[model samples]
Target: MKVGFDGKRATQNITGLGNYSRYLIRLLTKFHPHNQFLIYAITIPPPELAISEVEYRYPGKQLIKSYWRSFGIIKNLLRDNIDLFHGLSNEIPYSLKTAGIPTVVTIHDLIFIRYPQYYSFIDRLIYKYKYRYAALHADKVIAISKQTKQDLMHYFGVNEDKIEVIYQDCDVIFHQQVTSLMKDEIKKKYQLPEKYLLNVGTIEERKNLMLIAKALLRIDNIHLVVVGRETKYTLTVKQFIKQNQLSERVHFLHNVAHCDLPAIYQHAELLIYPSRFEGFGIPIVEALHSGIPVIAAKGSCLEEAGGPGSIYIDPDDDVELAKQVKGIIDNNETKMKMVRMGKQYLDNFKSKLISDQTIHLYQNVIDNAKR
Candidate 1:
């Protein structure tokens, strides 16, 4: 059987869905060498990257249709005589179902659906239309977490069987081994405090940085070292920090190197992810696997990622959030217990296991199609 995947999100500085797309491709190639895989990418998007038996076919800009939305993708499906074409991102050509081909799509989250406030009116319309298109058209949809699967069933009325739950894995390189001295050196290199709480994600309102800043203002002992790109909303946090005289207490770091992230996780006192919503919290799992305790927001997919490994806090309540952070730091026994349970929780989320399960889904989808 021949399978094709979207080559669009494979560009540099990949994060979230882009990382998911790339990792899925890499893992599929490693685990299933006998199957023919085509990575269908466009120009500048670049394609034809191979790992062992898998081939990336970037059907250049000339062959691809000239428009941007579902129309151009429809042309690609019409042109490629493939067994199955999967749109890794959410959008799919309206014509794909009509082309007598099978397609799979992955829905990372319905953040736009849940928090329509974050998006512009025009963007909201686009999101609604595209989500409806993908939900109605795709042969099968993969949800990154059970929460996402539930969201699809609740919001879009997608058939539960058509939606398969597949959890994502952390980067293989994240579980790096660094000595105590080396970890200390990394800490000094960043000028980070000996015991600081870390947060990793794009700095945005939905990420709930304001709540975190409010909590940081209450906590006197620990510093907050945030790692993510700056946005307009981040300036709001910065302004709050200055206005509240937390100039030294609250910190921000941007454009962090992937190589440097593992050490950042390992040496830190703990990781604090208080996002209002998420498809999956990859950093929480990374911190858990690294034996670092996690403090995450209570609702949404953050709870799913935390499972039994993390301590949950309400994103809206700064007093409660700060209390939890302090509770963990003040009590060594509770901190140690969370660390051990977090490691055990991480055992279920390994990259290889996820890859095998995904392969099973692909084979089942194809075999059922054959019948």
Candidate 2:
């Protein structure tokens, strides 16, 4: 059967959801190698020729194209002899009903429900209509975490069985072994010291990067290396570092290639994640699989991802975080202990394992529709 997928986020969003789209599509291509899948995307000024394959398809483009893709586009999808459609991010046309096609949407998180102020007025408006509505209407919903699934059930009042919990897999490159020499090579390349901590992701208020800076300021002979694009919120962190005279110690790495990340992970003495919230914590798995010890905030998804042996701290308590950072750095025995625990947790999230399960879920969704 020919499958239709939303590829709009592929070109638009560069961060979380876009990565999710790109990676999920890649996995689908591998596991369901024989099945024909068409990727549906919106473009301004349609391509002269449409690209078609078992993996992806670019149907049309532009405002007229979007309108057509939503309404008139169904005619083309029907013409393609498609059997089912899956909306990866959100905001399905709603017109899919017109074509008698079943639609599936994956709900990543519902931070908006708890902290609506974090979102702009228009963002909240769009989420209510495009995302929340799609979750309620879709034939099936894929939640990235059990926490997210629970959020969907309580806030949107959806059936539990309609939503499936599918934790995302780590990057294919992140593994439990990079040689000592390789770690040294990255150190030399980046001018990194032997003992330093690593933390990655957006530098925003919700991410609580300020807490990380506070934690690092108290620890002696240790530096924090941050990797991610700079945003307006980073100004506070930059200003804090300067005021505290830690400009020399705290380093900011903006826009590093994903390929070179494993070395950085290996270079770290430990990986610290103090995010106030998340749908799922990817870095914990990356650090665990990279054989690096993870230190993160308590009472969040980090606890679930880190399991045991990870150093958990109250994110708001700078004094406790400092104490943990010092203890973790000073003790080699502690680091080795956490590394062993992480290895066991890494097995369940192996890409091949989760990808196969996802494929099975897709097949189940298709099979149930027939009945």
Candidate 3:
């Protein structure tokens, strides 16, 4: 099979959608080397990711480059004779269907629609247009979680049959064991507390990080280690931390190298993700893969990502959140049980399994297109 991907995020982004794109490409290439893979992007991809098994293509002229991703890229797809083009993000080129190519798009989340206050009016309008168009027009839609699939059906009225729920795995590095020495070194380098609760993701309102900060007021000596890109919402989190006099207990680490994350996870007491919504919570899987217990918010697909053994609490209830944290921290037996169950739950999200399922989906889409 000759497969092409919308490699903008894979090549340009270092996290989130970019991670997803790279993971899919790397796994498919590793497990299915016989198939040809093409990565299409407007910019030149990072040198390390331009592997021999995959070919990279981009626009040459300025005019074509300006509209390449949405309109101009169709000619390139046709010229390359791509058997199938998968948009790793939420959009496929509007012209792909007209050009007779089967398209598959991965819709990570419909958070902007579900929680409109987190996004500006213009952003919501743009997302709704692009996401709706791609979901409606693509030959198949891949929702990262069942919650996202339901959102697609509700907001865009996409048929349930059109959407496939394929769970995403965290970075393969998380699955590897980190040495105690490495964990110690990372803790020292980052100035992380000896015992801390870990939270990973962008510090945004939608992430509900302030809930954790508020919960910290009730707990003693246990710090919260936050790792992710910071935004304007971070200012709000910081203000709350200062107002509550939690300056000594909250640590924020930004742009930490990807190689260092497993050690950070290994050293932490547990993972607390209070995000109000997610397509699928990769951090939950990352923490689980590290054999740490997890406490995530109740309202989204986090349960699917965190699995059955993980604890879920209301996003707004800091008291209950604090109780859960203290319980996990104080009770060794419960902590160990959660860790064991988390490891078992992570089996379903193995890279090989996800890659195989994706391959099967590709074949099904291709075969159906032929008829």
Candidate 4:
């Protein structure tokens, strides 16, 4: 089978949606080697993400890249005789079904719809049109979490039967053990404190990094090491940190290499993710596999990511957040037990299981098309 993917993010992005596209493609090629995979992108994928087994396709001479991805790509899909096309992002070509090809789309979240305040008006309008169209038209909708599946149904009136809730796994590197020497090297390279909590995500308003800064005030001794892209909210948190004299207590590391992230996770005492919302919190999963206890926000899909063993507190309650951190720090046994349970919970997100499920969905869509 020749399977094609909308590969804009896989080639162009390094984090978030880009990571998802690249990981999914890598998983499929590694596990289902019998099937041919094609990545259709505006630009060729970076060397690090490029797979030898897969073919990369681009527009021959068309300069308008976004237009080609949305409309012109359908012609290439037909020309290549792609058995199925999957939109790794939130959209598919507008005319795929009309051209008689079965299609699938992965909807990461409806954050723009759920939190309009976080996005520009034009972005919200564009996202709603694309996402709603894909949900209503695609042969199958892959929702990364049940929360996202529910959001699709509620926000776009998508049929529940059309959606599949498949969880995502972090890079295999996180599963590998980082040696003490490597940990020490990373620690020295970053000037990391001996004892520090970790938070990994874009420091944006929706991510709610201020909650952690507020909690840090009450807790003593341990510092915070934040690893992610800085946003305007970062300045807000910095202002508060300066005002509260937390310049030494909080360390922000941006653009850390992907390979070094697991070591950072390993060295951390705990992972505190106080984001107001998420589709599926990949950092929580990374922490689980890295053998650290996690304290995440409530009222989102974070529980699904953190599992029953990890701790949770209100996103707004810095007092409770501090209390939970203190509890974990004071009790080594409790922290270890949470780590143990989190690892056990990871069985549901094993790479083989997720890969096989995705392949099966593709096969099912193909079989139905035949009938």
Candidate 5:
């Protein structure tokens, strides 16, 4: 089968959705080499990010790039005779149904709908239109978590049977054990504390980094290492840190290379993710695979991602969050138990299992279209 992908994020973004797209493409190709895969990207990715066997197709003469990705990619899909097209992100071309392409879209989350206060008015409108359209029109909708699946039905009125919940795995590099030497080198290079809690994700309102800051007030000597892109919300977090004089204990590392994240995870005491919501918590998955205990906010899909081994606290309760952190840190038995169970739970999200499930979905869509 000649499967095509919406590669805008894969080619342009280096984190989050981009990582998901790239990881899916690589997983599919590595496990099922018999099929051909093509990426329809608005721009060519850097050479280092290119996949081994997959071909990339870019718009030839379309000047309005975003327009091409939305409606103009139809001509190219027809010419390529794509058997299936997967939107690895939350949207697909608005014209794919007219083109009769069997389409699948992965809706990571309905965060904008759930937490409108976090997004601009324009962004919310655009997201609602595109995500609702894709969810309603695509042959299949892939929700990274069950929480996202219910959101699709609740917000978009999508049929339950048409949506499939498929969990995504992190980059395989997280599974590899970082050596003691590499850990020391990375620790020194990044000036990370000898012992620290790790928090990974963009510093935004929905991510709720301030909760971690508030919890820090209760913990005695524990330090936090935050690695993510900074937004205006970061200033809010920094303001709290300054007011509380927690600057000496909290470290923010921006522009940390993706290749170095595993060593960073390996050296941490645990990962604290106090996000208010997520479609699927990839960082929690990464922390689990990296063999670290995880503490995440309770009201969303994080429990599904963290599994039974990790601790979950209410996002608004910093006191409970601090207690859990102290519990895991003070007791080695508790820490090791969480780590062992996390690894066992991670078996359900192995690359081969997820790749196989996706392939089966693709085949089912194509077969139904033919009939």
Candidate 6:
């Protein structure tokens, strides 16, 4: 079988959607080497992802490059005789179904619909239209979490059977145990506190980094290490830190190298993720794989991502967040229990298992299309 991918994020983005795209390709090639794979992208893939088994194709003309995936990529798929096309992002070429190719689209989240206030008006409109079109037209729709699947049915009225829930795995680097020497070196390089809580994700309003900063007021000794791209929301968090005189207690490490992330996770006491919503929290999985306990927000798909073993606190409650942090820090037995449980929960998201399931879906779609 020949499979093609919408590789925009795969080639260009280093995080989130890009990681998913690259990891999927990596797993499929590792576990199902018999099939041919093609990556369609306007930009060249980064050096780190220059895999030999995959063929890369670009748009024919610069004029069409901006919207090639939605408009002009079908011709390329047909030219390559692609038996299956997977949109690793939330959209596929609008003409893919019309071209009679079996298509699958991975919808990461419907947060724009679920929390409209968090997104701009135009973004919400565009996402709704693109998501609805892909969900309606694709042969199969893959939702990253059960919450996302439910959002598809509720917001767009997509049929239940049309959506499949597939969880994503963290990078293999997180699964490796870092040596204490390497941990100390990375900690020294980053000037991380001797004991600190970690938070990984964008510094955006919806991520709710302020809650974690507020929690710091009630807790002592332990600092908070935040790593991610900063947005305007970051200023609000910084202002809160200044007003509360937490300059020394909260550290923001922006654009840290991906290779160094595991050491940071390995040396951390725990991960605190207070996001208001998520499709799936990859950081929680990374924490679990890194053998660290996680304290994440309650009342969303985080429970599904962090699993039952991880602690959950109300997103709005800073007092409760402080208490959980202190409790986990003071009680070694409880922290160890959470770590053990998290490790057990991570088995369900093993890369090979997810890859095989995705391959099965592709085969089913192809067979049904042929009939």
> lDDT of candidate 6 vs native?
0.92
Where in model 5 is the C-alpha error above 4 Å? none
The 0-to-1 C-alpha lDDT of every candidate, in the order given, reads 0.79, 0.77, 0.91, 0.94, 0.94, 0.92
Ranking by lDDT: 4, 5, 6, 3, 1, 2
| Shift in Å, residue 218, candidate 4 | 1.0
Which RMSD does model 1 reach against the true structure? 2.5
The window of 10 residues in a row where model 4 has the poorest summed lDDT is 44-53
lDDT tens digits by residue: candidate 2, 33-84: 6877777777421232223333444455444766755566577678888777
Model 3 residue 321 CA deviation in Å: 0.4
| Candidate 3 deviant stretches above 4 angstroms | none
Task: Report the Cα RMSD per candidate.
Answer: 2.5, 3.1, 1.2, 0.8, 0.9, 1.0
Superior candidate under TM-score, 2 versus 6: 6
Query: How would you encode candidate 6's per-residue C-alpha lDDT over 214-331 as one tens digit per residue?
Result: 9999999999999999999999999999999999899999679999999999899999999999999999999999999999998779999999899899999999999999999999
List, in order, the clash count of every candidate structure. Answer: 0, 4, 0, 0, 0, 0
Candidate 3 to native Cα RMSD, angstroms: 1.2
Each model's TM-score? 0.92, 0.91, 0.97, 0.99, 0.98, 0.98
What tens digits encode model 4's per-residue C-alpha lDDT throughout 1-371? 88999988998888899999989989999999999999999987768877777899998798788899999999999999999999999999989989999999999999998899999999999999999999999999999999999999999999999999999999899998899999999999988999999999999999999999999999999999999999888999999999999999999996799999999999999999998899999999999999999999999899999999999999999999999999999999999999999999999899999999999999999999989
Q: Indicate whether candidate 1 or candidate 4 has the larger TM-score.
A: 4
lDDT of 5: 0.94
Q: List the lowest-lDDT window of 10 residues for candidate 3.
A: 45-54
TM for candidate 2 is 0.91
